[model samples]
Target: MMHVPPQAADARAKTGIPVLDERLRGGFPRPSTLLLFSDKPTEKRLFGENFAVQGVKAGDTSLYVDFFRAPQLARGELKRFGTIDPSKLVFVDATSSQLLLPSQEKYRISDIGSLTNIREAIVSAIEATAPSRIIVDSMEFLMDRFDKDDVLRLWHELIEAARANRAVICFLFINWTLLEEDLAQIRSMSDFVVEFQSSVRGGIVRNSMRISEMAENGIRTNWIPYAFKDLIGLTVYFPRILVTGPFNAGKSTVVRALAEKAISIDRMGTTVAFDYGNVNITGIEAEIFGTPGQERFEFIFKIFAREVSGVLLVIDATRPEELPRAKQMLDLVGPRIPYVVLANKSDLVGALSTEDIAHRMGLPSDVPVIPTVATESKGVRDALLLLAEMIIGVR
Candidate 1:
């Protein structure tokens, strides 16, 4: 009997999206095949494009097989993710042949009508460039032209290529024409299947994704809401980080200080509804939703607290009497969800110490109470960083 050492799993390749990377336990294992599928009309290709662009940004070679758009158009869209080094990216343009346009890319699929041409072009590029990542923009082009058996054979070849080169390959598919059995077979071949969908509620469209299957190193399947930002792609994002506390605690001030841009729903110099702001801090991206501190507007907590990643319990340090009301607001956010105390106006005369504030609130010793002067943005970043760490369970 031969004693053979088990091979170590491939190193993770981060997608440049912090939250999504956290969900993948750092990122996807190299050489794995991912099927990014959607049943509804959604921006599924953006996920795959981001995957390739992430590789290129990491100084690894990436091959993008574009079936729907021109190479120039694809390049333009890639700019939304971030600046890229063109030398690191190679394109297999399948669109040029269909449009009868001269392909400017180095690698060209000369004929889209023939499955053999598409397969050969893709395989040759995979072998020639040896990309660390590959993305087939959409399988619709191949599906519309070739038989299922032919496409299946091509799919097998893709898997084999990924295996041979230790590269991750992602196939983007919109599930309108495919039969259930066909979809099942495709899923069976993939190492990970990511299903995404979008819905509009209250005139706001929300998009989310979930890993439906994983053959090994199984994932806890959950629909994680995400959004694409300019120069940052596919964030497993939360649109709200409920910032709440008692009146005159600087909830709105903290939100404004933390956000690059903000809008407050206020009248008569008091927040009547909520303060909304988009925050990108310490590599964690989220929308900060600051609740009105007055007890009368407590009903609005139902609107802002939903799907919040964490809470920032703001209270005026000078007024320790407000600590009880601040603690009460935490109940609205609920238990089990991590939060940090922000003792704002700490620099004011006769302000209570962080220890005194926690004691007054009857919070446990481990509960962090960070002092801040929202007017000057003091301790604001630190408070946000601590809350972010707590939300991701890094603390």
Candidate 2:
């Protein structure tokens, strides 16, 4: 089974995003600064809000300083992130004073013109609450209104305050007009740099985030595609995952094990057309397509192979000779696609070990070869989840 070792509680602050937390070994390091830089603003805020709500759910104080919205409005919008303790989510309202309106939040920015006022308001909130997590949504507003040096000072001050409290702070920013040198400087000050990008393809907007750690031997994860749930927050998402192998490799069995509901087209107990299912796991959802494993049904691969997020290459561990045919099935699916090997029927007497199977198939050392008995549902979920980690570049 796939496993992510747990870290010390004091070492990290959990994001509460299931797949992401698994990869992070809990979450971002405590007493850290994260630069959430994006080309655009709208998409990145989702991640920030999720982080704040997660802190609240984890029983930690969260200080959210908003320069764009009223405290009440921000609080109302945050409800979409699911249930959070009202007392834990404290906000600094920066818009109400500009509109000459009475503020409901404990902290309010009275004068937008004064950089000193904004800095003090935020500093006071941090000092009073001793928050375990902080989010500035966002820095662009001040960056637009103040001098670069003044804004840089405010950024440094907030980081210091968070460090003092052993808190994790994220600064959301859009690259409106900053030079590369300034951007580099900001990145250098941060413990992690999270970059966001969005694109429209076939009329569907796809959002992705990439995280880069600044320490020696720090990790750089691939662009992980994600989507926000109505009230559950951010989740790692994959639209389609394909499963294939040689004849009688239990491709259909593996699909049924991973999916909540499944269907198969078969002839004489042999899948002749295909098997399909929908899988919903903690903070994840995917549609699984299992291709027929016989040479006569090879054309089925082309129909559903194009745009697969990942693949589960299943082979009967007892029949090592069938491994070549299994590789041929993958060849037909195309190349450069992420895949994990399932050594199916591993419980059988003649079954080969995972390492032996990998050597027989000539698979890369990095490719996972997990032992599984799909009919009994053993190691099935782990195989699929490992493939997800591969596709998301977290493993």
Candidate 3:
């Protein structure tokens, strides 16, 4: 029997997308395989490239293995994001000879006879540069050229080699190009899968991302909306505080008042599942998620509560007896999660005072309870700002 030494713990890296990072816990795990699938060109590939450039900018050596684009063309595309250090960024030219005959400047060319040669070049590059991150900006082209079994063999070999050397590997695959079985196998082997989809709603293009098969402690988020800027990599739109409470507590009205554009997924004038809205304060960027107040739908709480910066607990001011139910809902999320209480419908003739509602709910002295009339948007901004402060630990 042979005794092997223990390997060091994997180092985590940031994706530079704040909201996405929050959902990912920290970032992609080091020495793990990430698959990015998309039907459209440029969208997914650019994301992978930006990730590589972000690694380089963070002082980590990164390798970009291009099987489709020329090295200079890839570099030019990357420059749109930000300035990258030439020395820290290395390119494995796998498509140059495919476009033209072999030349002196060509680093490595991908051909039928020398398919193994490309794998060797990749392994050598990893050993030589010792990069923390490597992006094979795509596996689709290689999969098309080589036999299915051979491609999988090469993929396993190269990925295992990269992992042994403690480098994270990202393989970009086009979902529509590969066979269903091949795609399924690749996804099963991958540590994370990020899928991109674009839809036209009301004549507007909306890009969203869906994440599957994440690493341990991975916080799964809903289809988060994002966009690419010329300089910034990816900017995610984060929702404001999600307002939740007992059944018929005016949660929907609160979101409608607080949000510039809001949608209520209610049933028969009462919320049954969830609500979504967008709030843009002068100095704040927030999205509001309102969970169903019905006790039957409490399971949705865990899903929405994963990355919540703070929570807003809404209570009907007229129904003081329901305060305990609201408190119980907060208790479901556990302590240490920041939350504010809203005494909604205060404009009604016999509504409870903020302090009375808080006292009845047995809330701590530090908790702030604001009186609100959700129908008129009164105190909505104030409540959200207070929740934001609590999330940031300022209040």
Candidate 4:
């Protein structure tokens, strides 16, 4: 294992995830080391591949060193990240040697059996291309075959090589037989660590990731639920977010402002009985459910609001008199649920300030009271994002 030396704050090699990049204070710091560690066979490599491609999109040549898959297979798998500049993607063909075949790539690991040869091949690529991003698909292959001390020495050399070229290096490793002390050493050596996990239920699989910065005063995030799309690589996911508040607080408008397409049940085109829609923005995907504010439709709120991932409590900022009704509606959904208060109609003359609204509603300081003009789509996305962070348990 290698200790990540301190460097001045500089430009970053983004993770290609807008949500994570923003939280990372503009992505992984340049010339940094990242450890993608998992206990089992999780999709941790996907994040590394995404990070490499993002750098290519930024006009930097990238070096991808794979141990498990051949160059052709690796190229095909990377296409799932969408169209990339194939010319910018350089590969160090390590698999061809095991197959006892001549390689076609610019850099080939001719003698895969020797750790020194592997080191030379990788360092040669880094020094030659001066790539902005480098990824070692899986380190366990070499770790298992070579001496552990020798492998750690190579790890240190690679990190130093990447730093010399001003590149962000990522290593994907799945724990096989490492001891607790060894694992802790690996965690301490890296500048940043991103972990992946998966669970199966009823023939469905859910994936999530957690990020931690190893430096002092660094931020550690909760397990953020995510999914992969056809063209989009990584996106945060939130299912069953409830939108409920007092009647005429413009819940429908809030839903409409947030959702791409929405379906609502209305009586006489007046009071909305229900609203349901899917929202995707800034690399986040969510299913939103809106509930009518009237007491008669209380049954509807009862049906869908209990198991919600989060809540968007919309209230008319101009109609302070309806604050009590809004409080009652919020109470119906129960307490201790992660919710965001949206001061809708904030553009109106009589609209109240976010502070005043929060004070009047007796909300805690940690609870955000965002002012929004749903009709104009103002402040809506911010409120949802804040609520999503809260639901994801971001500290």
Candidate 5:
């Protein structure tokens, strides 16, 4: 027997979602099985589809076994993620009989009534195609119809086949049936488990994902908020650059200027929650989150402070007395994260110089204090670029 080393970071499959890929270090390990379980009606299939499409985008063959959706319907939905080469994707159609659609896939299950047919169709495709990646959407279709023990046995065999082929496989399942013991068995057999959850607040939907189990790095983190774009599929992304400062220091102005489209959760011209905007500049994608300047909202800092990639501390250049308060706000973001100071209102009368501002804030000599007029976007892009470079270690 020949021994094989674990997949390297660059060699791991890219999930096509930058933040998720970053959280995964690169992507799921090759020949590993991941269970995407969710009780809520979240976009679970979007994640699985993105994973399969990413493999196809990498010039590798991918297999998609559909139990709930027909082959055409699945392909159509996947196109919303990105355009893929049709030749690279092989579909195992187990729903055609139930859907009353003619089977055009490479492998077809003429009779979905029998568990043996489902198992034979999937197993044969896995062996014959030996694809680099595989996705089975809605495993509930099988578990609902077949015996639990038989389904588990077939699942284990598929896992073995994936390991032999050195392919990454993902199963999307809704947590409705199956006893707790059987669920535990399924989880134990998987290398990773990702769960999706969603909520409605103020008539707006917010989606998030939690990595419940990852055998490689064993990461267990809080629910990471995410959103989806029309053609870009699912994004488990929030590379945040926090802009915080004293009251009326143009923090919101800076956020609005940097964002292509922005919204502020303000009450009576004061941000009660936060200001958010998405920015894409020079190939660097980021989300700018501006915190409220008043000390009353200081308690809310801990909520949005996790996984901060960088910071842009905005301050009024004319108010040197508020420098300490601004420094205190920066402390809330914690140390060791790269940060740059923005002396806003530099165009105003009697504004303090960058040197004066830095000295008053007691910042180290190496920390940058850039002057800016946030309302006019003057010198704002420079401050953002500096922070971006600092985050990437290019500065």
Candidate 6:
């Protein structure tokens, strides 16, 4: 008997969601089955498409089996996220007889009615393309067309083929009309299950996700608010990153410096809900969030703390008295997450040194305390760079 060595265990790949990837330890197990379930159109399909595109862009061949959407429409939608090499992405159209031409001649169609023909078409696509990753846009459509047994049989064949070829397979399933037994069967065949749902609370729609069956331990994460940007893709916009201090502190100016463009959601020059900005920094690639220093909007801390990679706790060097509030907010985000303190408005007269600000904030001796003037963008870059390092854990 040939025994496979334990060291040969395949490494999982990240799905690009940092928090989610942490939950999966590394990422989804390669050459394993994954089921994406969502009843409503919560961008679940789009998420799967992007996941496959990421693999293809990384020089791995990928196959997208679309059962509902036309091939051209899918390709067009994917292009909005980023450029995908036409040579790397191949599509199998099980929806239409007419081949919706892709940017290149890499896409093909399978006969919708013939089971044998469909299977052969899939095999040919996989063999010809030699894809490292595969996504079936939906299994629900396949279930609707064939009997449960036939669908299950086809699924088994596909899973076996993917395993033999060392390819990861993602199956998308819409759960509206699916019976519980069918779902159970699908779950049994999958190594990972991701569920997306949307709820309306107080006239506001909120989207959330949960992951189950990702390895030995099932993973869970706090619900983070996200919105789909048409051209840029998904973004998490936290409303505030409170920068508080005594009177004459440079909290307002600090907000402006860190953000690309910011609005002081304050009244009479005092922040209420806090400061808001859609800031993006090069090489770091994250949403920059800031808050007000006032005490009234302390409730917003709970919202901002969720799903945060790291915190940038900014304070004023001129006001040593305001250091307590910065410490208080740091405690709110918990100690496990990395954070840095910024001594803003340092260019002004009588501004405390970086060491004094750190000591006053009760921050760790090694914690970074950057001195800056937010208006001129001085020290802002360093503060953001430190935060990014804390997020990815290099610095």
lDDT of 4 by residue, 192-214 (tens): 99999998645778888888889
Q: Which residues of candidate 1, in runs, are more than 4 Å off?
A: 1-10, 100-102, 248-250, 261-274, 299-311, 315-395
Question: Where is model 6 more than 4 Å wrong at Cα?
Answer: 1-27, 98-110, 179-181, 200-206, 229-232, 235-250, 265-274, 281-395
Q: Is candidate 2 or candidate 5 better by TM-score?
A: 2
Which of candidates 3 and 4 is the stronger one according to TM-score? 4
Predicted candidate 1 versus true structure: per-residue lDDT over 1-395, tens digit per residue? 22222225747778776655766777888778999998866877878887888889888889999888888888887888878899888999888889898988878999888888888889888888888889997886677778879988998998897777778899988877888998999999998898889988678898877775466647645566677778866665666788899987899999999999999988999998989998875346788898888888878987777767789989999987787788888887888777999989999899999988877778987789998999999999889877765665444
Tens-digit lDDT string for candidate 2 (64-167): 99888888888899888877789999998899888988877789888889988988898888888888889998898988988999999889998998887778
Ranking by TM-score: 2, 4, 1, 5, 6, 3
Model 6: clashing residue pairs? 240-290, 241-290, 241-291, 242-291, 242-292, 244-293
TM-score of 6: 0.68
Query: lDDT per residue, candidate 3, 1-395, as tens digits?
Result: 22222335746666877545544556777778888888666377767887888888888888888887778787887888878788888888887668665633324655534668888888877777778788987877876777778888888887887787677788888755666887778877888888888776558676767666565755444455556667777765444466899888888888888777888776688777788887755334667889987777988876787656578898899998888889888888779778988888999999998878877888899999999888887887788877765564333
Q: Which runs of model 4 end up more than 4 angstroms from their true locations?
A: 1-9, 201-203, 270-273, 295-299, 321-325, 328-336, 392-395
Q: Which RMSD does model 6 reach against the true structure?
A: 6.6
lDDT of each: 0.82, 0.87, 0.76, 0.87, 0.80, 0.68
* Candidate 5 local lDDT, 125-173, one digit each (tens): 8778778888988778778877888888988888887787788889888
Rank all candidate structures by their lDDT, best first, as comma-separated numbers.
4, 2, 1, 5, 3, 6
Point out where model 3 deviates above 4 Å.
Answer: 1-10, 39-42, 101-106, 110-113, 177-179, 214-219, 238-395
Q: How many collisions per candidate?
A: 0, 0, 4, 0, 0, 6
Name the top TM-score candidate: 2
Better of 1 and 2 by lDDT: 2
lDDT of 6 by residue, 85-188 (tens): 87788888776663433333345554577777777778777766667788988887777778878888988898987776667789888876777897788789
* TM-score of each candidate structure, all chains considered together: 0.77, 0.92, 0.63, 0.90, 0.71, 0.68
- After superposition, which runs of candidate 5 have C-alpha atoms over 4 Å from their true positions? 1-10, 99-101, 237-242, 247-253, 261-276, 280-313, 316-320, 327-395
Q: Which ten residues in a row have the lowest lDDT in candidate 1?
A: 1-10
